[model samples]
Target: MKKLCLGLPKGSLQEATIDMMKKAGYTVIVNSRSYYPTIDDDEISVRLIRPQDMSRYIEKGIIDAGLTGADWVKEAESDVRVVVSLIYAKQQLTKVKWVLAVPETSAIHTVNDLQGKKIATELVNVTRRYLAERGIVADIEFSHGATEAKAPDLVDAIVELTETGNSLRANKLRIVETIMESSTLLIANHNAWEDEWKRTKIENLAMLFEGAIIAREKVGLKMNVPNGALDQVLKKLPALRKPTISSLSEGAGYAIETVLDETIARKITPELKRAGAEGIIEYPLNKVIL
Candidate 1:
């Protein structure tokens, strides 16, 4: 079988993507100046490309599959099958938004207010289409970089992508409206999806990616409880599914284990301890395949 060529997104999403792949059981390593990353899987080869170029590359069959933001795929108008949506960005695991923002002191309070105003953004095509949809015409310029800083002085308004509004606020800008919400997507090329072996391989990788994402927000909890107090302990525990229960050696007690949200660990740990649970252990998880 031929090795599958996979395009990994470079730049801001690079580190997070690599970390996710590692948790999914793939060893990915990249040197400072290398565009090609090394992966442990012999069946796969990795190339680092920009997220904005991923969809077009995959659509042209330059790579079998890739990870990129949904907004870029839409902007490129690339025809690729979306395997799954991974809701994560550079800093947070949440949906990112493309928004129309203006200087805080500007009088443009609404989308319609920018009729003849100048707008700058990296997403020129997407912004053009958005404006055309609303029957609004404006001078939309393609900003090379620093889109947020172009507003007020460089342009009357700006369309920028943001995971959180903190950056815009830091630049003394306020969002007029959110143009679209996007998430990271795993996409497959058309021809590659038609091949049985390739399809199966992509699906397996998608499963692992999703499993790793789920694992990041959760943790494993294990504890020993007196057999008589098992019911009480179980009642106080929260799990993704049902908790795993086992009989301890010599029938001394019951061992219980479960996967739960990491955020509530602090609140639940003390409660379990007070309810006759012993040797309670909370540990981080790399992946959890359902």
Candidate 2:
């Protein structure tokens, strides 16, 4: 009965991570004010750690593996094995950006304009390196939080994470430069990854997580098509590879099932109906591993 230490990202990514685990066929229960969460899998021990520190912990082997932002891993300069890159965030399935921003009325309009200026951000190290790479020597200050609110009046500029530019716009800040674009990553400790048993377990988890994310954008569709209209129905359908066709035991037609993009489900349904697809069924999917 070997066990694997796993760290789930806390704060903003907490809910999404939990939901993903559920979709991946695991149940996780978090108690109020507790860092350790209860996961149904006895082989896994769960700890809730902030994404910012997740890489550091994994690098030090404090946890075997974790889910964290790619930005943090680069900022920390941690040495770890990346299991997978998950393209999802708090709201959308897209990479987020950390941008250099200044007040709309500020005199600085570009990264070069920030010479000898001060920039506030939680990602102080990465910001410093970014400025240095561009031969810009701006002072990088560590912001505790509310980094978006510290422009012009508080600091010369701010480097803040943004999924959409709306928040920066609302704060009267304009993006001057994109410092980094990051997505979530599943990373593992080098030592843990070397162990045969742990490596297999971590790899299995990665596959499940990946499958769950893919399942989000797809759905399972099942329908019946008449013998005469099978060609029409097949033409109207799209699939992961090809639709599954099976002869109906008591009919002059076939039962067809396939997986397709959720976004196109509605549009294709009516077309499928017109193509003589009957008893049409559309269902959600938990995992669609390829």
Candidate 3:
């Protein structure tokens, strides 16, 4: 098998990224002081590296693919091709604000308030262009980590990525403005995509990752309904595709199943129940393929 190199980000995001890989069916067992992780897939080479430098690494064709935040790739201004967005353990929640935050009690009330102020952020390039476009000039502080702590320490405000905003709230800071929204991105070297074997390996990994991520946000919903209510149930139930329909051996009933987004669970479940669906069940899924 042709070997394809993958760069896994190390740090807080490492644990979740590795978990995602395992769930996607590649065994990756990490150990402290080990940059290379043993994997079930002997065909691929896995290398753990700092995400801060991954964008350029991938762009320079040093690695075939890597996991890093969209914010970092933009900040690095590298020419890496983003293969996919992996939301990790938290899918729906990860696609959220990269915000400008300040202490709740601070005088900064809006984006306009950042003018002529100091702002600490890890996404200096992204933050700089954003601020520059608005004709606002601020003393931008480069933070390697914990940018949220900047405000309470009298750093004026900060531009940082937030998934739930809980960290910002705990730090006594409030979101002042949304600088940009970001999500975890699968990026690969442009030249790597030119090699059929290397490109195919990375693409397969991305496809598997997407399937796993989609399955997490959704479930296979199944239920039984009397044959007399088939039409009604079909009319009432919300489905992304045509629901799988099969008649029971008795012929007076049918089993129906469909994959649906969990976001509508509250409304869909009740509506389905009212439509004569019995023995309703929802099962979490991984790596759903079409």
- CA lDDT scores, all candidates in order: 0.94, 0.93, 0.83
The TM-score measured for candidate 2 stands at 0.98
| Pairs with steric clashes in candidate 1 | none
What lDDT score is found at residue 27 in candidate 3?
81
Instruction: Give all TM-scores, in the order shown.
Output: 0.98, 0.98, 0.89
For candidate 3, write residues 1-290 as lDDT tens digits: 67888999988678878777776888898878799988888788989988788898988888889998877888898998888887653434367668988888999897778889988988888999998899989999788787876676759998887778888989888887888876789999888988888888888998998877777777788999998888988887677688899998868799999888888765678888888889999887776865
73-148, model 1: which lDDT tens digit per residue? Answer: 9999999999999977899989999999999999999989989989999999999999999999999999999888
Per-model C-alpha RMSD:
0.9, 1.0, 2.4
Where model 2 places Cα greater than 4 Å from the true spot, the runs are none
lDDT of 3 at 37: 88
Q: Pick the candidate with the highest lDDT.
A: 1
Q: Model 3 — TM-score against the truth?
A: 0.89
